[model samples]
Target: MGKIVWSVNFTLDGVVQDPTGEEGFRHGGWFGQFGGKDLDEWAKALFAEALGTEALLLGRRSYEYFVARGWASRSGEWADRLNSLPKYIVSSTLEEPKWSNSTVLKGEAVREVSKLKQERDGDMVVYGSYQLGRMLMEHDLVDELRLMVFPVVLGTGERFFGETGDKKPMRLINARTVGDSLVLLAYELVRDA
Candidate 1:
């Protein structure tokens, strides 16, 4: 069975919207606002995670965002891996996926993703799909979380997590500082028996 790992970059204040500023969020581009050795380290960490990922699980909006940003045409080890990996997009309205090796999951998000976890092996990483992530967490389908928390706190924006209606316990598997500004945290969801 595969684990659904939700990997994302968010600010100190839990804002996960438009880190790249491409979405035109009022306080966008907080991701690239910092520079230096820390930024490079963060990039390396992301690349390492991408290398280990078995497949990509994305929401429709994130799929569009990546496609619009030209992730498909980009070249490099990381870009190549991302482009070639099997992309499972959770979208009811998307008729056909434009990116290569992409498939649209048209059923209910939770059920579709739960089936996906059983069919695949290794980690199916979800990136920047806040709504999908929330849904998965609420349904207790997310197995792990890899969060790279940036130092800045964008006072207002869409947060990564929402109310799940109950407390979800997590065990911190790893914690480290990436460069000088970013903190990388890995947590395994503690499921009830």
Candidate 2:
């Protein structure tokens, strides 16, 4: 069985919206505004890992955004393999997946992801699907988490964690400084027996 992993770029305060120029968040393009040498180095490392993934589990919005230009438009092994590897999207309204080597996951998101994890053969990664991420976290479907903590805070925007009825405890397995102030945190969900 393959592990379900989440890789999300966030602010120091945990905001995941547009931080650069104007492409990240839906409203303001404040995501990459603070990207410097450190941020670049951090991004390179993150993309390297993302490239090694065998599959991508995305929400409807992320699926559409990624497929809009096709994964091949990007460089490196990740882009090449992503274009050829399997992509599973959780969406009810998306009638079809236009991207190559893509599949639309129907039915309940949590159940489908659980089933996929049980049968998958390699690394399965998920990007910024807050809704699906929350659902997966609630059901205890995720195995690993990679958090790229940025330097700035947007005060308010989309959040990585939401009210999922309870707090989920995680065990940190790895921690490193990527670029400048960006912190890359790798953690595992602690399960109670």
Candidate 3:
């Protein structure tokens, strides 16, 4: 069965909004503040993670964001892998996805994702889809979380975790430093019997 892994870049304060500063969030561009060898290591870590994942699961907003940023047309190992990977986009209104190997899941999000987990055999990573991530967490559909935490703390903005009603316990499976400043933390959800 497939594991739904919600993986993304986060700040010390849990903010995941507009790391590139493209969006007009008040604390936008927190990701670009760091540089030097550490930033190179961070990029390498991100590339490794992308290469390791079997597929991509994204919400409509994130799908649009990536497409708008020209990831669909970019030519490189990372961009090519991303464009070639099977993508499951969870969107009610998106009738046709323009990205290659894209599939739209228009049914109820929880049910659709649950069926997806049963049908696939590898990890489907969700990146930059906070709303979808929260929904998956609430429904107990998320299998793991892989967070690349940056050094700075954004006091305000969209966060990775929201109100999920109940506590979702997790077991730390891996923890390491991506660079001098960036930390990679992987946690598996502890499911009840």
Candidate 4:
């Protein structure tokens, strides 16, 4: 069975809105301010995460942003792996997805994801799909959660965990500081074990 993995970079205040300033967000670009060994380690961690991802699950806004942000244009092993991977976008309103190996999942997200979790594929890595992530989490479909938590706090923005589905218990499998202040945290949903 496939596992749905939700991975994202978040601020200390739980904000996961736009990290880059290009999205016209007033408080964006906070993620790029860090550098040195910490940044390097975090980047390496990101690469490792991508390497393990079998597919990508994204939302409409995030899908457009990723394509516009030129993730496909960037030439490298990461770019190649990222762009070539099967991408499933949960958007009832989206007509066509231009990216390679991209599919627009028009069915209800929760039902579709439940079916997806039963597939014989590898892990399904979710990027910046806030609404979709919420739906999946709310439906108890997410198997693993990863957060690259930064040090700064943004008082206002869309948060990563504004509220979980319910009182779902999570087991912290791994937690470590990636850079100067960024912490890479991994948790598994405790359904049984």
True-structure lDDT of candidate 3: 0.91
Candidate 3 per-residue lDDT, tens place, 1-193, comes to 9989998888999999889998899889999998887789987887888888899999999999989989999999989989989999999999989999999999999999999999998889999799999999999998999998999977899888887788888999999987688899999999882
Ranking the candidates on lDDT from highest down gives: 1, 3, 4, 2
User: Number of backbone collisions per candidate, in order?
Assistant: 0, 15, 0, 1
The candidate that wins on TM-score is 1
| Residue 190 Cα positional deviation in candidate 3, in Å, after optimal superposition | 0.6
RMSD of 4: 1.7
Candidate 2 residue 89 Cα shift, in angstroms, is: 0.3
lDDT of 1 at 139: 91
lDDT of 2 at 21: 47
The alpha-carbon deviation from the true structure for residue 82 of candidate 1, after best TM-score superposition, in angstroms, is 0.7
Q: Report model 3's TM-score to 2 decimal places.
A: 0.95
Better of 2 and 4 by lDDT: 4
Model 4 segments more than 4 A misplaced: none
* Candidate 1 residue-wise lDDT, 1-193, digit = tens: 9999999899999999888888789999998898899889988998999999999999999999999989989999989999999999999999988899999999988888989999999999999899999999999999999999999988999998888889999999999999987899999999883
- Better TM-score candidate (1, 4): 1
- For candidate 4, give the lDDT: 0.86
Candidate 2 residues lying further than 4 Å off, grouped into runs, are 20-27, 72-76
Tell me which of candidates 2 and 3 scores higher on lDDT: 3
- Model 1 reaches what TM-score against the true structure? 0.96
